[model samples]
Target: MAGFVNVRRDVDDKFYRYRMPILLTKIEGKGNGIKTVVPNMADVARALSRPPTYPTKFFGSELGAQTSVDEKNDRYIVNGAHDATRLRELLDAFIDKFVLCGSCKNPETDLILTKNEMIVRDCKACGERTNVDMRHRLSTYIIKNPPPKKGKKSKGGHAEAPSPPNKINGENGDPDGEENGAGSDDELTRRIKAEAAELNADTALAKEDWSADTSPEAVERRARALQSGIASLAVSNNGGDDDSDEDADSPYSQLGRWLQENPGSSAIDVFKKVQELGIEKKHKAVQVLAQGVFTEDVVAEIPKYVAIFAKMVTSEKHQKALLGGIERLAGLDYPDLVPSIPKILMQFYQADVLEEEVVKTWGTHVSKKYVDKETSKRVRKASEPFLKVTEHFRCTGNRAN
Candidate 1:
């Protein structure tokens, strides 16, 4: 009859032991699923047709043992003390089929029984050491088991995998639903090209046949189409109205002609046209016309015009035109320019103006805005400590005194 032992190593490097007998019996419907089961000494000895032995040894030694047999279950329990080498060999054999590191999945490892009451194993791959625990070993064994075979496809053919849960909006719909915000760059480009094609067809039809001096209905239809073309171009360029030098006969020229003819048109109409023109073209036109013709009447009607221009400066597309406009006004000392200065300075202070070129340009205009002596002095003082630190470290030798 085979025997089993339960052994524990104590802090004093001594082994405490208990013993039992191994039993074998056919468990109906539990063939391959049989797991190692521990039984008490009395039951184990009874199963083994042997008398129970509590705190008994195979021979006479400090090593301890206990034995039991269970006739009813046909099982036995054997426990005993073991030396480090013997315990290691038993543990290695018991855990041989499942000793992989859970985290790193390293199979090759050295078993280390420590004096500090830890059975540690070091993984060769990831250099991670883990304690040998029964729970961990059992879990690793279950994880290593192969998955069950999948069933065959149905007669209707293989069903599609269910769509993953939608993170945004959480609507239970097809993943290929309507796209939000700006569509993909390729899709946008395709749409723009298609729209441009339609616009070109309409423009060609108008030029070859219908004249603006013809019927009022025809003229109105043409104007509407032209307006749409301009709007489409403006949105495509992100409100940039500047035309490149390469395109000699640009859309802006057509829009500009329409604007000049319809001088009494609404601000919204003008704004739409302005949005259509390339950004540089819009700025150039606005700068020239605003100063010359924006007159007292126009300024009163659109008090927000200067404010809009100041806001436009924040945009990358219009930054150069905006900075140039500011510099020109600062040099000419334009009367209406003072009110826009505070808004510009606040923006400049907030923006990432770190580069030397940007700083130099900003420094020239910044001093002009700081007119209040006390406020200017306080601002300088606040920055002095940081300046001093930089100077001390020789990062920038010049510091505000």
Candidate 2:
């Protein structure tokens, strides 16, 4: 059996967070009728979060071949004797342009049809939104037959929704009619509802604290971490007093608090505030600024802050502080998004907020200065795929020299 492969085969295969089945192609109907049947197209499409027809039509668009979709039968066909490797390569191209987020490179995205008939990729991973290239022929097909709207409730409401008739009278006018097995279905539904009610009545699980620590003390600790952590790291890096007491109204703390309070502030507004605080000259301020400015949507927000960061992160040490801030943000605040650290780092690097050498150097070692040791290690492990690529290129360049 052909096991699964990473959705982006270009990325490290060991990374199993995003994966899809290997393309399996079988040639059938020899001669002009010959076609390649993708038996597992539905599975692969499901993994990529795309309709099977999109990739099926994509294959036809790229190969200049006729394609057929048997959605009811889970069959997708592309005319001609094409090999699996060729189809897989084309699929990767499709994934890059259509599936992955243009900013973060994460594949957890959806194709949304706009009122103007354009399609946009809405990334769930980092909340990045970008327009799909309409130049491709598949775009026309996708626009015409867009993906179905998910999780939409009917305006009629649940009570107004149609259900099968409870009974259908036979020649004998029987009240317990078995038409379409309605009687058995009703019994099964009653059993399920009773079980669900019992589960809902279990108050212990519901009362348990399943969410993050939002108690007053926990909140105060988090506030302190935000206010003091970055400055301590920066001071420690500079061979200064790491144990020095910082007031609640210190410049860095003020910047962090302001960013937390007014997250929707524009880059120009934030830069203006930074100037007002007279902290623009302090590169260490970049650390606290980054930690406060971004939330779960850090990847998407990077582009909008490029101008401000270009001013703040002027040197390697500043870039390191930026990375440290991101570590705290992802590791401590948003642990669920830790797997996206590589994409987040890439977004920063692409925006010129962090230097490539600085990212490579930071990824090499896990430091507890920004976050706890375990979290720092986890973040670095998540980043290994990106780090390894940069290391490979550096080593190759050295060999060529």
Candidate 3:
């Protein structure tokens, strides 16, 4: 019989798709020297998309015992008499903290160490990059032994696949099992020359784009070549995925385009158009609507959009989604929008859209979806006013208990 279960599902879930092998622990030794051996740690770690040594080290750190992972024998051992039940409980904590994404609770995430040495999780499913909690001892270990760097993907979809090596049997034989090798030799030489010519042409074009001659004629030629290359590369990168832009066909993109096209459109008119066009998700619409509606006087207009925000954050799920979008929309793009975000958030508080729990969740991490690192930092800095409101509620014992 199979002996595995989904890490975060009910123990009785019969058809849960996400499964990891059961923690098979064998307690060995007696009296003063006791240890638990996890014989299938490598398999478990493979399923969890983590290095086996991480969990091994985590167990030692948590249990206040020594642990070792013997790669040669595929053995993971922790000193002490631990049971499957305790280890399973520990696994839940690990999954919650390190495995699942904070936004979507999906396990499809990669642990990234940024240039600032901050540990973060990049959720592949939702495109949310969240900073990891750094208070735990395991966090220290993770920082020291960070995951390997992932290759950069082309904007199309995934990283470029390497060109396959050409197969040649110059010394031994021909693929057709020919009795004579004379004809095959001539064919191979012709093929090599054609391939070399193609490579030379590509090199010449790339070199032309990089030419830095300062003469007037040469400068014009260089500019034309550079422009052509950039245009081609941009088209290649954007061909596969629907990268966001002002011209995209998505409802959010249409809203942004319409806003830029019709700056004088009334709020009622904008809302009507949004309804007629049909927004797929209100959370995403928040970002588009913010970008389209607000200008230098965003603070004065916060009340105008209060009804929209109220509808967006009506439930806990909506609150998380809307906050994620807000982290991007109110991010750092609008210097005008930045100064007013704190007051906008306070309105959320007064409207009960941003409850105390939601506010606490927003402060948990820096989001990197709609904004860059520095921009996100600025947005969070501008949000200090909302923090005071939440703190006031917390200090006065008005937290949602």
- Candidate number of the best lDDT: 2
CA displacement after TM-score superposition, residue 24 of candidate 2 (Å): 48
Which window of 10 residues has the lowest lDDT sum in candidate 1?
54-63
Angstrom error at residue 125, model 1: 49
Candidate scoring better on lDDT of 2 and 3: 2
| TM-score of candidate 2 versus the correct structure, residues matched by position | 0.41
- TM-scores for all candidates: the values are 0.21, 0.41, 0.37
Q: After superposition, how far is residue 253 of candidate 2 from its true place, in Å?
A: 1.0
Error of 2 at 242 (Å): 11
Q: How many backbone clashes does candidate 3 have?
A: 0
Tens digit of lDDT per residue, candidate 2, span 203-296?
Answer: 7544544344546776565556555544454334362313222666777767777875565576667877886876664555777777777655
Write model 1 residue lDDT over 112-224, tens digit each, in one string.
33323234556666888886552222221111111111244322122223222211101122221122111122322332233234435455433553212435664454345
By summed lDDT, the worst window of 10 consecutive residues in model 3 runs over: 163-172
Model 1 RMSD to the real structure?
31.6
lDDT of residue 97 for candidate 1: 24
Give the clash total for candidate 1: 29
